[model samples]
Target chain A: MSGQTVANLMRGHIEALAARGERTDGRGANEFRDVSIETGLIGTAEGSARVTLGETTVMCGVKLLAGTPYPDSPGRGSMTTTAELACLASEQFEPGPPREPAIELARVVDRGIRESQMIDFEGLCIEHGEKVWVVFIDMHILDYGGNLFDCCTLAAASALAHAKIPNVQHGIADKDVDLPISCWPISCTFAKLGETIVLDPNHDEEMVMSARLTVAHDENGNLRAMQKGYNGAFTVDEIKTAVKTARTADKVLRKALKEATK
Target chain B: MAGGNSDIKFIKKGKRLDGRKPDELRKVRIEVGVLNRADGSCYLEWGNNKVYAGVFGPIECHPRHKQQQDRAIVQARYTMAPFSVNDRKRPGYDRRSSEISYIISQALERVVMVEQFPRAAIRVDMQVVEAHAGTRCAALTAASVALADAGIPMRDIIPSCAAGKVSDTVVLDLNKEEDNYGQADLPLAIVPSTGEVVLLQLDGHLTPDEFEQAFDMAYKGCMDIYEIQRAALADRYGGSA
Candidate 1:
């Protein structure tokens, strides 16, 4: 069969399964896949974490360097997020500069961490406006099982939590210090299959899903970031339900993140 | 471990710094078909280096001009993650990666029977998630297995290994510290059956006698690696091949 025909068949199969309140992986609509997070896996980086959401795996590394702070945020440290969806992760990802999917993944993960104020940026300043710590968060997609947004965000947040300022290396201080983390923000992703929204869609489910929604919540249950993906639209009721699902899902993730970082 | 290079003893007595003999190769572990989305993939951990290789293709070539009328084009891209080394590498392709990618493509192309698929393209992507030393050899070895796992026809599975001179002794495989302070480095890829040297790269300094010894050591290392490659494939295919 042609590729599209096979996709259509899979889509039909998924919709049929969804209507029965089940997923292809035999999980409930609100259930998430197994998540395992390991922190400090990359020795070179100040902090790093490897997250596995089911079969999908992503590695996030935090590299801190001393540089001139931005003029707009002079007293605060700066953070730049970048995501690479290398061809090694999947055949669909080509070898080139960052593409749309990668850029989108980075931005969504960035928004969750930055908007949540998870890192105490002001404390990172070495000198009033001259020199400050700049943190680079790099998200590398090693395996594309699915639900990359949530996985990337989790990896980034965990890595940030594990990060320490390389003060001695940068000649800013006599010893290293832990990054000031104020809050933990966890993201949950869901895909709409026909009329049903499934939490943490795997690769096949993502390929056939109509729309994607990712919701990030902080420790206090405040929604910090939201992203709507794909060309499909969701009903107002579906949006409300997604937020509720995300809030509940983040509880498990936050606990896992804490354990991993600790 | 600190101060001057000469102060750091790369070799002591009969063993190297990591407590291995000069001709010892690091422990290697290979797992094939690790990625579900790729046509074929392999995850390799050699010493402290973690590398993944994925093969995609024999598909129609993009940008028509890049296609060859008589043979498929093999394009290999080698990338190191930002946190792969002691210092974080900036994201994006750099001169070193470009050179390694080119050399890897040339090496794989020699063994892959590309002429059968005209106007097509085969892409091999090698990502180094962790690096100690000899990443190029590990990447090439993994890529060759990934190609075979993808069911691509080839003259033979290519295995690569590196030997370098440290503390005036030619070692079979150099680790991170040895690579940093080693006198000479020689990385080579060979077709075990045909004994053809497809890839050869050298750096540092070596006497003619030392060069021959290193070459012999590297070849032996490759032959050892070739057996592991075959076992990996057999494990995946139930020993049919």
Candidate 2:
């Protein structure tokens, strides 16, 4: 059978399940999969973490290098988040430079960390405008079971939380120190499947879902970043409910992040 | 001769740095079918080196012009992650990577039965996530296993290893420090069953006798690694081969 035919069949089956207030994997409408994280796996990187949300897996590595800070962010450390939808992760992904989906993934994950003010950017400065620490968060998708937005965000945040300034290695300081972090930001992603809103959509659900909504919240439950994806519309009531659901869901994610980093 | 670091003693008595004999290979670990999306995949960790290889296709070749009417083409890309080395490497393909990629493609082409699939392409992507030394050999070894896992028809698995001269002593598997100051380096890949050398590259200098010894050492190392590759494949299927 053609791929489209299989997708259509699965979509119909998923919609039927949704109509009954259930999910294909037997989870509740707002339930998320089990999340597990491992840290410090990449020895060459200053900090690294591998996060598994259900079957989806991502590896985030942070490299600290001394370079000129950006013109707008002079005296503050700069950061660039790059997401590679590695061909090994999914059949749909191709091998090459970052494409549209990969770019969007990076931007969305960046928005969460940057808007949350998770890192102490100014504290990373070694000199006023001459030199500063630049953090590069490279997110590699090892498996794309689905919901990369939340997985990438979680991986990036956890990696940043574990990062250390290799000051001594660069001969700038007498000792190495942890990267300054001020807050923890967690993101929740929901897929609109027919009339139902499912949390942490898997690969099958993603193929059939009409739209995706991702909301990031800081530890204090303040909204930091939000992105709506796909060519689909949602009612005001649905958006409002999504925000409320995101805030509540973040608590569980934050707990897992804390335990993983600890 | 490449300049050697006089302060560092690469070899003493019959043992080399890291306490290994001249002909000893590093500890190796291999796992196959590690990726869910790729047709085949392999992960390898040799000493401090880490590599991942993924294979795609026997599918249609892209760009129309690159396709062959009578056979498939094996395209290999060997890349090192930015943080794989002591100093951060910029992301993107450089001359070194392109050369290694070309050599790896040629090596695998000798073993894979590309003629079976006309007008198709088999892509092998080898990524070095961490590096100490001998990354090319590690990448090629991993790629071979990935090809086997992909179920691509092949005459044999290609196994690779490197031997180099450090401080006037020929040694198997040069590490980072040794490579930087070694007098000579030879990386070799072979079809173990056929005993045919599929890939060979050398730099620095060595006498004919020393070259022969280094080649012999690298061949032995490749043979040992080939056994590990077979064991990894056997382990994937849960039985002895």
DockQ class, candidate 2: medium
Model 2, B111-227: lDDT tens per residue?
999999999989888878789889999999999999999999999999999999987889999988888888888999999889999999999889999999999999999999999
For all the predictions, what are the DockQ values?
0.62, 0.54
- What is the C-alpha lDDT profile of model 1 across B1-241, one tens digit per residue? 1222545678889999899999999999999998766788999999988899988888777768999999998889999998787567889999999999999999998999999999988989999988999999999999999999999999999999999888778899889888887787899999988999999999988899999999999999999999899999999988654
In candidate 1, which residue ranges exceed 4 Å CA deviation? A1-5, A171-174, B1-9, B235-237
Candidate 2: Cα lDDT at B166 = 88
How does model 2 score by TM-score?
0.94
- As for candidate 2, its clashing pairs are none
| Highest-TM-score candidate | 2
What DockQ score does model 2 reach against the true complex? 0.54
Clashing pairs in 1: none
